[model samples]
Structure formats: structure tokens, C-alpha cells
Target: MSAYTIRDATEADVPAIARVYEHAVLHGTATYELVPPPEAEMLTRFRAISGDGYPYIVAEDADGTLLGYAYGSAFRTRPAYRWSVEDSVYLEPSAQGRGIGLALLLRLVELCGELGFRQMIAVIGGGEHRPSIRIHEKAGFRHLGVMEASGFKFGRWIDTVLMQLPLGEGRDTLPDEATYPGTLFRG
Candidate 1:
């Protein structure tokens, strides 16, 4: 068996999730936020995602230390966008280069597909952030395009890269609208 485990994140994991994201916000261009959000804020965001019936999961080692997290959020708030989702993944240093990130992402893809989502997009921050891009690529995502100089952080302009993957049928076949989930989406 692998040294790490991947599972759905719970409320109790918020602190560790915050810590992982804080590392990225402070030291890496993987995220553009210059300041780390507080733990409480992280909890609120986590609750929102879970409440929306989206998948929020984490990776942990044998000792149960959180290594990273990955989730699928609404790609857009519009009703038409309900079938699409955008992926967000964050990996703590301990989990980097070990394929744990890929495992987490692929799992999110699987869960989202089961939830009736048709498309998954990865909006990676920092155009140069290849490891994140590679993880998405490894999950079968394809390059869409890049938005140059869209964000200014740390005294430099950062680009956003876009990649997309088709979940079940992609666009080859029309969805059976009657069987869709979240039909009552109050969002």
C-alpha cells in the first residue's frame, strides 16, 4: 500500500487545510493571495463547498498528517454553469513530487463525474506553475489558453493558465436533464 491516504475532508481537518494553503499564499505563486486567510475563514469556505454538494477531500500520510487538499467548485454561478466545475488543489511541501497531488486530483475528478458534472476546468495561478499544470495534465486535462499579466502579486505580474477535461460523456452526447443533480440549486 502507499504511504499516504486520500479521503473526504471533514470539519476537523480545517486547521491543517488552512496551514497548507497558508504556505502557498506566503511563499509560492501557486496562489496570488499575498495574505493567508485565517482558519475560521477556511472553515467557512469549506462549509460552503461541502454544503453545495461538491467534493472536498484531502491527502494524509500514515500518521494522518494532512499532506494536501483538492476540491471542485462551481465554475460559474450561473444556472447554465451547473454542469461545469473548476478544480482547486493545494499541496503542502511534504506531499510534493510524490504523486499524492495527482491522486487527490484524479479522485476529485471521479467524484465530480459521479455527481453529474460534465466538464472540469483547472484555473491554475502563475502561468509558470508547471507542477500544478502537470498534475492536471496527468489527469487528462488539455491546455485551453493563458491570460497574461492578469494578476499582480509580489511586485510582479502573474499569468493564469487554463486547462480542461471532460468527465463522463464530455460533449459527445447530450445530458439527460431529468437525471441531473442539484436541480433545486438555490445558489
Candidate 2:
């Protein structure tokens, strides 16, 4: 809604993404990890997402200041779980309250649904992260309850809230890159 552009991420956006993620790790309970990964390691993780034909996108201004990013990746390694994906989204500390996270997440759902995903999952911190929960619910994800005390971080136990959105009914087949190469998203 603010005219930011969404595009598939390449290796070059790694540093911007890492910086945004680092802010969350340091200040917010959104991510359970204690220490932020180095830029190099972060790039490695994103590269794995790209290599798997998943969606990794960046929201940016015309001059390329990153506002936020969202992406979808395999929920589990097993082939049986290929049609379901776990989604991750993060906004720059300076970008919150401006709808960047919602915009990024909406685009993620667009891409995931087009790429043949049947179900999308979001894992959020319980109670303390209401903004994120509201964003996902606004975008149509259903609350699937919490995993109590599932993670230990910042010297205390944390709860994980799982939410999911089904892309659509049927369409259970796997993604066909051969038939749909270079198209960003299609219904």
C-alpha cells in the first residue's frame, strides 16, 4: 500500500536482511535464538532457501533501503510434507507500524499459493508478540494453539504459537518449475 516493491531475493540482499534480523534477535522476543548469526552464515541459510526453489523476497524502496522480507520454506524435510511450508517474516525496527510486515506477508502468501503450496504455517512467540499474531490473523492464518514452554531463551522459557492458512482446496500436486519457470506468482 505504500508503494514498496517486492521481489525475489538474490544473494546480494543478505546483509540488509541480516541487519533487520539482528535487530529482532537483540530487541524482540519474535525470534528465539539468543545470538544473531553473522552475515556470512545468514547468507548461507538464505542460499539454502533459494536452492530449494522456495520464496525469499525483500520489500524495498526505489533506492533499495530494505523495509522487510518474507519467505516460505519446507515445513519438514520429508517428501510427504512438501506441499506444506513454514513462513518467516521480519520488518526492520524502523519499518514497524507502517504496514511493511503485512505487505511482505501478503506477498509471501501470494507466492506460496502460486508455487503449489497447500498449507502455510507461522510460528510466533506466545502472548508477548500480539502484533505479529494480529498481522497473521488479518492475513487469514488460523491460530492452531501454543506449544507451551517449548523454547528457552533470554534466561526464561518461551511459548510458541502456531498458526496456519490453507492456500486453497485441492491442488495437492508438487510445484512444477518446468511448466512455470520465471513466473513470480500465478493463481
Candidate 3:
């Protein structure tokens, strides 16, 4: 097993997180974004998700070097979609093929469940991206479907694969007002 620790992310971690994401955006198809967002933009995004009570976490090795980061965000801006969250995970090149991605994803699922999220979605960028698909599958996510040619990155068309995992109670029960995800949207 890898000797890595996973913990809640802080403002101090944004720079490393941004670096990891920038690498993905530039060299990998995991994200469709062509231009890497600056650290300041990443910090704003982190604050938004953290402010909404969503979980954002980072993983580090025994030496305390950041290996990767993951987080859950509202699937959509609409209130009806509040109970569903979309997850994103990015890792450093040196950290790939280790168990860090799975560790981070499982923790994200656990935290989202505790926050009363009904569903967790993984929007895998390319249909050919098996590593991401495998990680989500190992984390209890099911293959939802795929949108072919949904994105054009790296001068080629890419397919987007959607996977989903049901969180606490999922949609089997209606959420009480206190547990409703829309509560975050309320003024």
C-alpha cells in the first residue's frame, strides 16, 4: 500500500492543485479546458465549493508532497440538480498508476454522502480514458452512458463518458428540508 495521507484542502493547497490541473488541461484530455486557469481562479473555485459545504481534499506522500486532489461540486447551477454533484480529480504525472486517485475519489464519495448528496457523477473526458473509468468503477460508480464527440480537444474529437454512484439514500427517499441540497442556495 502507498504511504499517503488524505486531508481536507486549504487555501495553501491551491497552488499545487492548480499545477496538477494545469498539467491535465495541457497534456491530458481528462478536462476539456484548453487554457489552464491561474491559481487565483482555482482559489475562487475552491472557495465556492468549500463555502457550499462540499468536500475538497488533497493527498500527500509520507514526505508531504502533494500527489493529487479531488472534490465534489454541484452538478448544475439549478436548484433541482442540487442533490447531484459532479466530481473531478487530478493527479501529478509522477502520481499516476498509484492508488491515490481511488483513495481521493472514495473519500469524496464518503464526504458527499455525509453532506446528504443523493448522487455523484463522474464526467470522464474521453471514452479512451480507461484509468479514470476504472477508478470510478472501483469506487462503486456505474456506467451511465457516453456522449460521443462531445468535445474537441487536442485537435481531435473526444467522447465524454458519464458514470454515477448513488450516495446516502439516493433518490429512494425524499430529502427533508434540513438535508435538502438546495439549502445551500437559499439566502
Candidate 1, residue 45: lDDT: 95
Ranking of predictions according to TM-score = 3, 1, 2
Q: What is the lDDT of residue 151 in candidate 2?
A: 79
Q: How do the residues 37-87 of candidate 2 rate in per-residue lDDT, one tens digit apiece?
A: 999999999988877778999999877898888888877776656677889
**Top-scoring candidate (TM-score):** 3
Give per-residue CA lDDT, model 3, range 7-45, as digits (tens): 999999999999999999999999999999999999999
lDDT of 1 by residue, 83-140 (tens): 8989999998967898988999999999999988899988899988989999998899
Worst ten-residue run, lDDT, model 1?
Answer: 178-187
Candidate 2 Cα misplacement greater than 4 A, ranges = 170-187
The candidate scoring highest on lDDT is: 3
Q: Relative to the true structure, how large is the alpha-carbon lDDT of every model?
A: 0.89, 0.82, 0.92
Q: Cα-based RMSD of the predictions, in order?
A: 1.7, 4.3, 1.2
Q: Give candidate 1's total backbone clashes.
A: 0
> Could you tell which candidate, 1 or 3, scores higher by lDDT?
3
TM-score: model 1 vs. ground truth: 0.94
